[model samples]
Target chain A: MKPFSTMKLAVAFGTAALAALLTAPANAAIVLGGDNGWEVSYGGFINLFFTQSDFDSQVPACAGPTCSEDSTHMQEGLLPAFHTLTAKSPEIGGLKGTAQITFAPDSSGSKAQRLNKGGAMIDMREVFFNVSGDFGTISAGRTLALFQRQAILKDMTLFGVGALVGPDGGGTSLGRIGFGYVYPDFRTRFTYKTNDINGFNLEVGLFDPQETTGTAAEETDTPQFQTEMTYTTGFEGGSFNAWAGFLWQELEVQASTGGATGDIESFGWNVGVDVKMGGFNVVGSYYDGQALGTLLFPNVAQSYACDAFNCEEAENDGFYVQGTYTFNGKTKLGVSYGESNQDGTATGAPESDNSLWTVGVYHDINSWLKVVAEYDHQDSETLGNEADIFGVGGFILW
Target chain B: MFSKINIVRFLLALLVTASWSPLARADEDIWKSGLNLYVRLTEQDDAASGRPVPNQHPVNLDPAAIANSLIDIQVWDKHWFKKDEIEEVFSPEQARLLGQQLAIALRKASPGQDIVFAVSRTDTKFLGFRDLSYTAGRAFYSNDRLNIIIGDFMRPPDKFQERATSSAGVMEIKYYFRHGRRDDPSDFESAVMTGDGVEVYNEGGKRRLDWLVIDVNRASAARLAEEKAGEEANAPVSDEALRQEAARFAQERREMRLEMARMRKEVGSGQTGAESTAPIESRLKTLDELRQKKLISDEEYERKRQDILNDL
Candidate 1:
């Protein structure tokens, strides 16, 4: 419990710090190396927001004692602002390569973390490198997970508040994450991507696998494997880019009794699309598979129990769809909805059907300032409560 | 992590080699490679919308040096339109028509440039309603007019999703310069002050980026200028020197004007005795002709007229 709480606080503070930093005036870039060598620069942004939530009091019949959801507080936006250091090689034979490090910290308590006070915690989010040429670009690092990359990236609430995952704490909103699909946490891996093959291409990679509950990290000998095939076509008016991706990994769990000790397998797949036509943009994603936990993959629900010689697996699936339209280049209106659930197991209880719906508007006041307002409704059968959250905030990027 | 180490090692090694690249030359030519040390420094300034480099400032480069050491290397290109397919897009007829249209429009604003020949059109998805074409061709002032050979045909293959400039039908490209200097000394000074700098636009062709980039041409001549601003591309210039040059030019202009007045008076006085009486009258007539033809303003003609009378 302490570890979970600490991790949550870390994420909250890291995101808040990013938001606060965004509000700071643009500063001089940190440059390393010299005039004819490698050059590196550092930059990032910060976002802060305020929310007012009035959770519905209705509880399911089997609801437990913990059912509070209403809250009023300042919180970080859906995505944490991260500072990054990008280094590049001086040109040699017309080709160059780049390496980047994205470091972010979590805020202490206040969502605003005004003046960067409240003792924030640091989170090393990503480190990656790429060497590009006429052939293509190959990248290796502990960066964003490949599965459902475009869906979450293109979400209207990507930088806005939605789903109220942490209505009480300034943690973070699920933002259709738990409600529809699992979180694709950053993973250590390598990927190979092709150049635009007539506006279409493919990406494939292998990632470090996560160990299940009661199992050591070494228990899983094999790495997770994944691939994504994307098709993008440009029409007279706009363009459409769609992708299908799949991930598979094996996990080992030690027997609590004497049954679930053999190697277990987890596999999942996802499909998504992004369309930008005129001033309108639309995005949709759907995912399903076995042993894919509801909130985040390889989560507690994904753990299986064994009875001497028998083991039971968890089957899971979910999806989300969203649409947005830009008006006059300054204002954008958007809406999104999603739902996800896990099947009941023979040895454990079934996961609840979680659903979330969000509506928001964002306005770019200037190059540095963006203002947003959103309303979200969340329903959970397992948590046994429905919550509605209203939030408004501003984001600054420097 | 080892990958990162290898990248650092590679960068270090390349640094050793880059010191020899023409980018290090004292008089590097940006028209050849584009990436130069001076430009890199200016590109790093992100504090304001205004960049360090001034617009439409002529940067002088040694043609002999360029011919000897320049190597044309394209660091960036999506190759959306292949070389063979370019003609299909920027056809001769298209270039001519666009160039003629620009000639009609730019005659006053851009007095030296007559046409925009380097023709490129908007992509089907280029977020606008009209079919506007960009004049990526180079504009050179020649024979008292700006002459652009429209139809260079190898530049800016579409991609203007933001500023849609065409209305009704496709209007010719407008001529504009930084601060609207119009081929003046201040304009050249602006260009020289900042040197040549290029911004690394976040081009999205690379699959590994997971991001998007916005790019624009920073060169004064054309939108499809070299990718990076070359190192030491501009001659070492000081504000004091520029002031001196302006003063010298002013002095020269005054002497030339006075000399021209003397020549006109001599011509009016006639080479033979028969026309000597008609000199002043003829000179006045000539001054009025110059004014009526708009060759000189009222004040300039009056000044010349008084100078010719004084000569008598």
Candidate 2:
């Protein structure tokens, strides 16, 4: 259904209909359901932030079974500014829509650079409609993949660590405009919300990379998929929330002779808690997953866990501690420290561990506006390392 | 005589409430949102034409109020007796000045509340079992007699007070007059009152009259009042003040009559032990006490008291 168009029609006709019903005399015989209904509200927020990071060339890198130090391969700090716009529709028929567009400036800053920037100036961050009721909510269109669900809850911030992860790996932003569907995945979902069971709630969704417009080579163009499940509940004033999920990807690597490639699957699970006491909140979680076979870079001859279907795997595990305090009814200060260890069959990739620490402050300008500034730093102890980023962004919506 | 005691108790409640009752004038019961104030009239202690309630007796306040921090009851004030002096002796202008002074004190005691006496005439309370009174009397007392001896003199002549200690004097005042009766107490109290007449007086002044029509709903009252006016029963209700007053009276009368019918229907309902908000017997006893004490107009007492019980 064209939800947007349908919403427009409902809004157009709802005004006169409401007036007529309210003005009508009251009678027990007539059911006055929609007369008391209200129209939806609309608002949105956008945030743009500039980040500059300098990498030290002294970081050590070793290769082969022995230690062989590499020369200083470093460049000056790079400055990148990313801007995103998020818009939301007022809730109608228990459904609301959201869309986000991200833009980044190109170097050679002026008009000449824009001409040769190769359409890289803009990106679709998130665009989807969420339909929900007492039964359950569904989101169809391009949105966060399943792998991001658990992390999304843990990260708390929409534009944080969880959003960057592709669910299986620690942080991999994959596939623009992925198709996401949340079915009553019994394992990961609450099937009885409509029936009113209060103790537990669960949900599961799968994100597939199949384009909106079908392509002839379906197998070749079909994007990798991820599935996730989450459960949440509250007991005796404390809440318990948990989630787990997996991702599968296909990489048709360049063949040594004939072109041939295989797909790979990676799975992970996350468990976390939000313990609240007085005004202080403490969060803790443990996540472990494996990235096996040739998931990223393909090995053509390796029979690697080969069945008629081809797939590889890798393993990773991480945990984090985050806390936030709210006061003055407007601003909140938060800090989190996390570490993850990534290990795989690939060489020079020895149990690579990464640590992330972030401190941020968020000020709610008003009910519909908020300003956020956060400093995030990551230290990777492996080959493809030397990567650190700082992000400060803000969002608004109504 | 038994009924007279209840009346005295009822009036004493009124007297005590009048002289020292925390029922009103102190601006003590300040309420915040989300908190409900439920009133249950336990019993009446004393009833008389004029009684001096000196110091307010301290009682064990509701513990729930502390946690809720939102609900409370200003049951009794020690200065209630002294406070009533202003109402009894001061002229309108004087009363206004006194009201202003008390208002300041009230503001100091309970901020955010307009410091004004809780109007006694319009507000109703169950003085005892089957006894109800709408009379006004001085109800205040100091926290201490400054030298009064601790004795049984404090206890009110009621089931709950009988079992309570003399220190319960303040409690008796608080429970019987100031606060509503408690749901549970340490006694097998017979919530009954036997009395002769009821009294009615239009102490009606400038105050918000919360007219409760026992059994009449809003629609029915409007319909009845309209029909009486010889207007189309379904005519749109005018927003005029006079029409609103008529509609209000119609509702109140309907409620009174409906309450009476409901009592008749429940005559053999076999329900016992504080079924009504206030016992009908209590109202009867209070009237008897008032008549014996000559504290109220006999005709008014008889007429209004019966008006109350006839509903039962």
The number of the candidate with the highest TM-score is 1
- After TM-score superposition, the amount by which residue A40's alpha carbon in candidate 2 deviates from its true location, in angstroms, is 6.3
lDDT of 1 at A199: 42
- Residues A212-311 of candidate 2: C-alpha lDDT, one tens digit per residue: 1233321322233344444444322134555454444333322212222343333444566656442356777666555421112112122123333333
DockQ for each of the predicted structures, in order? 0.02, 0.01
**lDDT values for all models:** 0.52, 0.34
Error of 1 at B241 (Å): 26
True contacts kept of 2: 0.00
| Model 2 regions lying over 4 Å from their true place | A1-41, A50-52, A58-121, A125-139, A156-196, A209-226, A235-238, A248-263, A292-312, A346-351, A381-398, B1-312
Tens digits of lDDT, candidate 1, B24-123: 3122112211111010011111112343223122322233222211111112211334422111223344434433433333332222222222233554
Q: What is the C-alpha RMSD of each candidate to the true structure, in Å?
A: 20.3, 27.2
Q: Estimate, for each residue in A1-398, the C-alpha lDDT of model 1 and write its tens digit.
A: 11345533654575456335333322324357666577876656667778898765445443544555457887777666566677776655545566777776543244454333234556666777665556565666777777766566667777687776444555555676777777777777766666545445566665767765544522665457666666665432356777777777766665546445655567777888888776688888898877777777777444454566656667778888888888865788999898888887776636568888999999877544688999988887644568888889877654
